[model samples]
Target: MDRKTELKEKRKKIVAGLEETYQKLVEYKRYKKSPLIIAKNGEVLEIAPEEILPTTPYITNS
Candidate 1:
């Protein structure tokens, strides 16, 4: 095994992941309000609010 080989393998994996994400986004119409939502901060537990909530709410990062 060599350094170049390892790098090529890593790059391949990254490209595969990016492709998968792109496909998911393209086929996202079936999934409305995706259950697999990402919460990058605190107070993100409650989703699907009926009314308007303040944007830029106080949410601490993990």
Candidate 2:
């Protein structure tokens, strides 16, 4: 197989297992004491004790 096809197949296989992983992360983020949870490019980031502002008021006033 070509290198591009090999990489695509590898990515597909990696993505196939992510559903369960994301489910577990959602549950953990809900229960854990963190305000932000981000997953990107194979990295997981957690921001603790952050503030969540109401965006609707800010958006409508502009």
Candidate 3:
């Protein structure tokens, strides 16, 4: 593969890993009944677990 192609593949893997990690984090927070804190538009917000929505669909291995 060309260097550019290799870099692209690496980036894809990184993004996928980050997405999976984020899903797990959301689940953990929900399980712990903790809030999801985020910063947007120079404002900090604490979203309740019940209000937090996963950015990706939940995947299960069966």
Q: Tell me the whole-model lDDT of each prediction, alpha carbons only.
A: 0.51, 0.56, 0.86
TM-score of each: 0.46, 0.37, 0.84
Residue 16 accuracy (lDDT) in model 1:
72
Clashing pairs for predicted structure model 2, backbone only = none
Q: Over the stretch 1-62, how does candidate 3's per-residue lDDT look in tens digits?
A: 99989987897787789888988999999999999999999999999998888876535342
Ranking by lDDT: 3, 2, 1
Clashes of 3: 0
**lDDT of each residue in 1-62, candidate 1, tens digit only:** 89989987887777677667655653452345433334556544534433223222233232
What root-mean-square deviation over C-alphas does model 3 reach? Answer: 6.6
Candidate 3 pairs with clashing backbones: none
Candidate 2: which stretches are off by over 4 Å?
31-35, 38-62
- Stronger candidate by lDDT (2 vs 3): 3
Between candidates 1 and 2, which one is better according to TM-score?
A: 1
The per-residue C-alpha lDDT of model 2 at residue 14 equals: 66
Q: State residue 51's C-alpha deviation in candidate 1, in Å.
A: 32
